[model samples]
Target chain A: MRLINHIPGRPAALLLAALPFIMIFVAYSIASDIRLTANPQDKLLPAPTTIVETAERLFTVPDKRSKEILLWNDTFASLARLLGGVTISAMLSLALGLAIGLLPYARSLFSGFIAVLSMVPPLALLPILFIVFGLGEVSKVVLIVIGITPFMTRDLAQRVMEIPKEQIVKAQTLGASSWVIALRVALPQILPRLISNVRLSLGSAWLFLIAAEAVASNVGLGYRIFLVRRYLAMDVILTYVIWITVLAFVIDWLLKSLSRRAFPWMEANL
Target chain B: MSFVSVTNVWQRYGNRSILERVNVAVDEAEFISIVGASGCGKSTFLRMLLAEERPHKGDISIEGGETAVEPNRERGVVFQKYSVFPHLTVRENLIAAESFDKPFGRLRGTARKQAEQRADTMLERIGLNHVAQQYPASLSGGMQQRLAIGQAMTAKPRILLLDEPFGALDPGTRLQMHDFLLELRDETNMTVFMVTHDLDEAFKLGDRVLVFDKPRWDPQDPGLFGATITYDFDARNKGMPFQDILDQYPSLSLG
Candidate 1:
């Protein structure tokens, strides 16, 4: 079989995507068996059975203290923060991006500033964010916002700039005011791009969210993973990590499909 | 008196001169076609009329307005590409053109119905009623251009500026568009200022054909001055032979 570019049928394509995952599972199972044979209580390599049990317990059973399914709670909290930060950033990016792109004065004022802002490593400001925003949900959400907003704004601003000058000029000739041109002509065109940008920025958004939760929060998938690390709870950690991966994949897929369906005209070149 | 007048207009980009002292007086409902060599300021002069750019010296007055400002509904333009909004369906594009100045681009019940009715009529006129619900991307080049022209005309602009509107179409499609434009102009009595590289197109559709070129070559200050109306021919006068006009401006006559 060729290593690349072979057009596989549906089942084969699914299998091809699942290949690496299956390999990892088998390899880990074999290593776990070996370690368990040597020392049955080894925490480093948990068996598949151990991971499955942990997943079931985490998903179904309630936390002893809070009487809530910790897994679902973590999922909800993380998703809310992620979506909140991303939604705010998307709106801000659209506004500032349109302004910076369409107006010469705004471009001159903000383009360089935004470029420099994006260059500052967001993680480096984590401690300052914690101190300033008080390590609450505000700081966590703000971290994700600050972490992704500048990059998104820059991306969207560049996208706005790339909007053919003809479109803007044509909008003007159609008796559209500047407001109408920005909100109507430019906004609809950039929304699909915004989705694409958010999809690309999802990785960093997850990173900042997890880092924030791991450092300060008592709730979240990240906090749970970090909390269990001292006990060397590899089974729970591995399950949580896989769940997070699944969630990220689902979010990205949903966004991509939404963009494709809602804005079919966007993929003209594709 | 001229309905559209350009007096002593000059255009410069950095040190390069594109247009200089261009004067033209266009009566109401007059179809004017502008032709010139590549980089000879035909499009630049058209841009001035569209109010996309201002002349560094002098002014262009449309319908007695003394100074050209940003493009408005009074002047409609069709570019070679992207004249239609790709995101909107054909009907929506026409409606948008009609409703852009309305509050929030909304037309109330009867107004909305009336707008849709007008859009449908225009769709039928352009023979695009079959694809009224489709997006511009799905349409062929000729169909899309027709939609764009219909969209621009739905707003009823006093003048239409076409920047090589058929430059990208096939020869057959170009001829078809030529007839469509002539019919539309005759029906609406719309004044048109078209810029094209096709001399035949300029002569075929224009009531008055203008050629912009550098009349005097200055070896010392080559870029100091710009193109001007070097030749003006009355296309409505069929007695004035094509070869005679071509003989007057040898640089402008080509395939």
Candidate 2:
């Protein structure tokens, strides 16, 4: 007897997708229960109820010292730094990348240098950035920018290079100047690719952001997590980690939806 | 003096020559077809006229003006592939074609309305009104070619340069496109210069045909020289009536 392997339908697929998470939850819950039973105070893995209570308190209650909701403050600070760094990096890369991709002189002058610069690890320069920029928000935001700008610029430049030569020639024949071709013919095509590139680079951006904040910051997600770690605050750390993962996932989904709605002609892979 | 003139034009890439000392003149509203082997200089000559590339020697001028330097709205071109912008819908493509010369600030209000009207008329004439919102990728090969041609015609250029516009079409569709092109030409009275490999296509659509080849080819030294217009036949009278001229120039090879 032969058994055929067929693709699962929607409901089966959803159940299959949820299976791994359920297993992980059950395993963690059982471990937590055993540890708590062995000793009523287990800091390594707290019970699920402790985590829920911590979440409710952290979300609703305000800090007695600062008079501000800690979670919201942390979220707002981190998001502002991230948005500021990424927006500036994106705009700069678009202009620089187009010049590098379209103009021979610009490509020859900076392409090799940019390639070499991309090789140097961004984390290695964190100490220097902290030294020069000091322990302010500037260093944190600058770290995020420095971490992802070269990669994003290179990606956008490569995307621009991949545009068909015929389109450039056609645009020229259509009375578009070099600048016009750069803006109208090439920029529109690469915008969706840029968004996809930004989506891919978000992980690295977050890594740098957290590292910078953890090293030195009064407020932010990473600062709060690192601060509470001295007291073995596992529940707070777990809640924050899960919250960060959800936030990242939602941002990715929003960018993808934006790309689809704005530039419907882009291939579906983007 | 003709409307378009190619005088002592020669093209070289480093040491290798592509076209050497070529010369031709074409009047207004003339449909000239160029035929040759794949590596021949017919397409290169067309490129020179379009000002995509400048000849190493001599010049190509239109309407007694300065030597052509770069491609502009005065010369419209349709390539064998990617003839239409994939990002744009058919109607937008046509509208953009007419609005190309206008300043960015002036592309709104009355100018935009007029451009849309022109695009609608062109779409109706080309029988693409139903798929006006469709992108070039979704259209069939023949339909894309029609849209490409229609897109080029919308610019109202003085000369339309086609680089094998029908080379990618099937036999039936190619024939239909030929009729469509002839009708379009008659209606608009636009000058056309086409490069193709099919001799029958050249004969069918052209008022004159130019053949590019090397007249003197040495087996060992084939790289020393380049191809030139070895034969220019007047195809004004249809049905292969240039037999007498072919007989007179016995060295001419039809293929």
* RMSD (CA, Å), each prediction: 4.8, 4.3
- Candidate 1 local Cα displacement, residue A2, angstroms: 11
Q: What TM-score fits each model?
A: 0.94, 0.93
lDDT of each residue in B1-255, candidate 1, tens digit only: 689989899999999898888999999998999999999999988888888998899979987787767888888989999898888889999999977887566568998899999999999999999988888989999998998899889988889999999999999999999999989989999999999999899888998999999987789998977999998888876526574777678888786
| Residue runs of model 2 more than 4 Å from their true location after superposition | A1-5, A267-269, B242-255
**Candidate 2 collision pairs:** none
What is the C-alpha lDDT profile of model 2 across A68-90, one tens digit per residue? 89999999999899888888788
- For model 1 the local lDDT of residue A166 reads 79
- Docking tier of model 2: it is medium
Q: Report the error of model 2 at residue A76, Å.
A: 0.6
Q: Weakest 10 consecutive residues, lDDT, candidate 1 chain A?
A: A261-270
In the range A1-270, model 1's lDDT, one tens digit per residue, is 777966889999999999999999899999999999999889999999989999999999998998999999999999999999989888888889999988899999999999999899999999999899897888888888899899889888888888888788888888888788887788888889899889999999999999999999988999999999999999999999999999999999999889889997766542
Task: Give a tens-digit lDDT track for model 2, residues B81-143.
Answer: 888888888998888687655555126888899888999999999989999998877898889
C-alpha lDDT of residue A46 in model 2: 96
